[model samples]
Target: MTIKKFQGRTESEASEKAKKELGENCVIMNVKEIKPKGFLSAFKSSTFEVTAAVEEKEKSFDPSTAFKNMPKAKSVNVVANEKIEIPSFNTSPVKDRVITPAEPKADSAISMFSRTKEKEEKELEQKISNLQSRIDDEIIKKEIEAEDKAEEQKSSENRQPTKLKRKNENFEFIKTLYEVLIENEVDEKYVNQIMDEMEKVNWGGNNVDTILSAVYQKMILKFGQPKGIDISKKPSIVFFIGPTGVGKTTTIAKIASKYKIEKGKKVAFLAADTYRIAAAEQLRTYANILDSPMKIVYSPEELNGAIDEVKGYDLVLVDTAGLSHKNETQRADVKNLIDSVDEKYNKAVYLVISATTKYKDLLEITDTYKEISDYNLVFTKLDETSCYGNLLNIKLHTGAALSYVTTGQNVPDDIEVFDTQKIVKQLLGGR
Candidate 1:
């Protein structure tokens, strides 16, 4: 008997293959559906695995006159070419009987049956040994073939490059740029927009550097320009709101220090962040260093009083408690505090975001924040990461302009006013 496995798109195809190899008499043992593995297999359909077997046919057994025509054993002596009359044994206990020479055949055929059975056993053993050897050889051959196929598959996979490797130079540039944007945590939709724009350009060139510059220019055109602080009143109220640990307080301090020391404009600190321990003290410490007065407001009414205290000052930088976007009550409270401010003071709200945040989370946070307060974006922790695609992503997503970007922890020196050319340089991996 021999067994083999065959696979094809359909059961009929697999059965045909099995029959071609194992003859029409092969028996179908098992059938199963199987899917291939690997990158390309994702697009391929499943196949059927069919196990079939074939066996050598054996002769039918006969009982009556089984050894009547059996050949005489070589050990038996023939007398004058006469047929030899083999002796037969009687197993009955009544009387022991033996066949005489006159009897051509034995009525009790025990001895004759014993000799014939022994010869049949020897022939069956030889056939079984040959079948076992053939089965072993087939198994070894299949194993070797499997090993060779594995090696070939590994080699083919290793040699595979990007699917776009053979595309035109312009396409290569666009693909590389798309990867860079995605690596920088840019939103997929915005990345697609960039790609679509890149595809529209009529320019032709293979130089990667040139293509990078072209992409940078296109981004700049899309990002547009940054908006400056709106200090149109005596005390322009600028509120900084964002998720916890995004450095909202620090960013407010930076802007405050810049206005007070460098620009010589009167600036006061107002913090409504009573949730965290020593939240007010943190701002007080910075205020003390700059010889500026700091005020802590616990409620909306107190926030109104704080705004009145800073009415004579040129600028009022307000820092609210960092709340998770998931906390709806706290976010609404922050929005109420901003609403309580006097309408006389020109208001400018800035949503402080961390540059290191993932694009998906940023989108969620911004979406939630947009429902509470409309504001321009202020990005912090630029020094901590290299991915700036989020900057353009947020800009395009919210239709808001960027105001300030903080590079490091320094109070006055680390903050930079948003500039288009500078941003283009940063986006292109420049210093």
Candidate 2:
């Protein structure tokens, strides 16, 4: 590195001057403007009175060892008539003699003191420059990091939500049946065929769960369920996604209650849906009833950390926001929540649907959620429905399987294991 000062020239011109003498790689650390020459010198502008003086920082930055790749300096002074007045500046020129660490003696003390003073001043200047460079580097790095974060957030915001809109509610019957088909572990494609059939029928007001369970069993007997990831040996962590105010927190509570009490599994709830004021409170309300540990994760980073900390539990349920089925961006946002934690730890995702919803609305709901759904469909409010044909219809549209069939708003009594034949008989008003 070199400090090349070219008077009456732009920075680029100063660079060229330094390069002509010190080769192309010679770094221009700084530049300074010199005073104009005497009265006659000022008038003769074209003759060039001001001279560009470049000094090599040899001892301070030795090419031989400082940087292994530095080219060997093979420079010669050019013959220029302009007398360069050595500017008496704050910094000492490198031409000053090296300060040696000689032992203090009566004869050399005075001289040593002078050298020590000079050395201290030079060292102080060097320290300041080094610190400045380090600070500049840190600022640059921080700026780059901030820009990257902003870009990522912007990209996330630009994405549309994943839920599809339910148009005219025509496919409701099929959607209901599709939910059941998925629960029975039927193949996704066959379940979809059922949806196609149910769509042709286009009838409204079928019971979501019962019909779904029936068609699901039929599809499984005929086609077979989608290959579900085995979570028996591993940890059982689940995430629930669906439209808003559809009993997401309640369903989570039901699952936790059933597992902890009936199945005798250790359960914990991690409340990831911090968006709503009552969301976490509602989950807490359930947690209090089940007497299982409930934790809230305010950030994605926190969510990941909590999952790591809450190991050794039999079941962990992460609850998400009740985003509109019509909003697509909500998919990615929900995905971030899923990704923030370990969804791979998740063996199952439960799509909770209200059994009271109409058949066409049910179809639209399932279709809207089809893109991101791989979990089983858990239907709630089954007691509210007389017609269970919608369940059959849901099995036809979305290929999700049934995990549990929720009947009422009751905590323990309203939820049940998805039994195909029993549900069909019950739906038809048979014993």
Candidate 3:
């Protein structure tokens, strides 16, 4: 018998390959699907291997009468071209042994054929024992591989939940942040815009700290840069204008004290708030404290005259009357006061607003002043309100640069340059 193994991409293909090489009479001994092993095995293809055997033709062999005269055995049954397991027999001298009649003459063909059959059976048994040993080894190897695979699969299953839990935690953390923004009175529109921007960033890991840092940086960028009074020019005229009772006069005094007392610059006060006598008097008090010049201008012509008086001064801070945004005549007066400044001198406008104002009123006030002139933002009364949403809202509404934020009525002491980081941290529920 001749035996060989053939392989193909599938069982049928392997069978066909074996048949093509081993002929139609070939017997299939075994068929096994061979799978690639290891981590990258999933990317590879599996194959089938077929072991086949064929019997060689013999001219002297006669199958019809070969075993006709052979004596029957009690334990053995043989099949052609198939593996057989031989039974073990006791070989002790005391054990019973079968005794048969004497064989035919040695010259006879039957006697010679019988001896050949015995020799072939012994050789076949030896081959079967060797094949069984190989099969046993392969079975043990496959079992160990299967156990290792099962352990690896269990480990993978154990680790899957940790990844899922972290993802869920990240989602909850973001949700909490959203709630914090809402609770802080941040406008829904701006809050959504911030969250949408955060989503667009490609953070390799969705760690909570990483997400928080990203959100902080994004808000800081959105706030842009805060610009204060620029006194680089020989004379800088800064106009403070806003609606009624938003701390316009006091904010001006604070700025004046900062430039006059702290920096020792040549500062002057121009009070354009003729509608309120107390407003002019309040500014006069601050001007007297700093020993600076004070001028009250009632019209555009008066404003130009007042500008000439303060020509040699390094800084001129103007305080405008706080009036209703609905009053068209007052809005026009403030606009004229700002436009009356001489072109040769540098001028800056600041729109003072209160932090405690309602968002709706803030929108209206900012919109009204936007038509007057381009201005920077100054938010006052920060100590009265815990929520600073209006500050951000007005800043975005006007697209104006933020200049100063005052926490109290104290001149210069309660005021500081706009701190974008501090405001963002408070918005995100941090101290």
Per lDDT, the best of the predicted structures is 3
User: Which digits, one per residue and each the tens of the lDDT, describe model 1 over residues 139-193?
Assistant: 7798899999999988877655332342366676667667767777677787887
Q: Which residue pairs clash within candidate 3? A: none
For candidate 3, write residues 297-320 as lDDT tens digits: 888888877888888999999999
Clash count, predicted structure 1: 0
- Can you tell me which runs of candidate 1 are displaced by over 4 Å? 1-167, 205-213
Rank order by lDDT, top first? Answer: 3, 1, 2
In model 2, the runs with Cα more than 4 Å from the true position are 1-231, 426-431
TM-score of each: 0.58, 0.47, 0.72
Stretches of model 3 off by over 4 angstroms after superposition:
1-119, 122-149, 201-205
lDDT string for model 2 (42-90, tens) is: 5644321223334444444343433343333233121222121221222
Clashing residue pairs for model 1: none
lDDT, model 3: 0.81
lDDT on C-alpha atoms for all candidate structures: 0.77, 0.62, 0.81
On lDDT, who's better, 2 or 3? 3
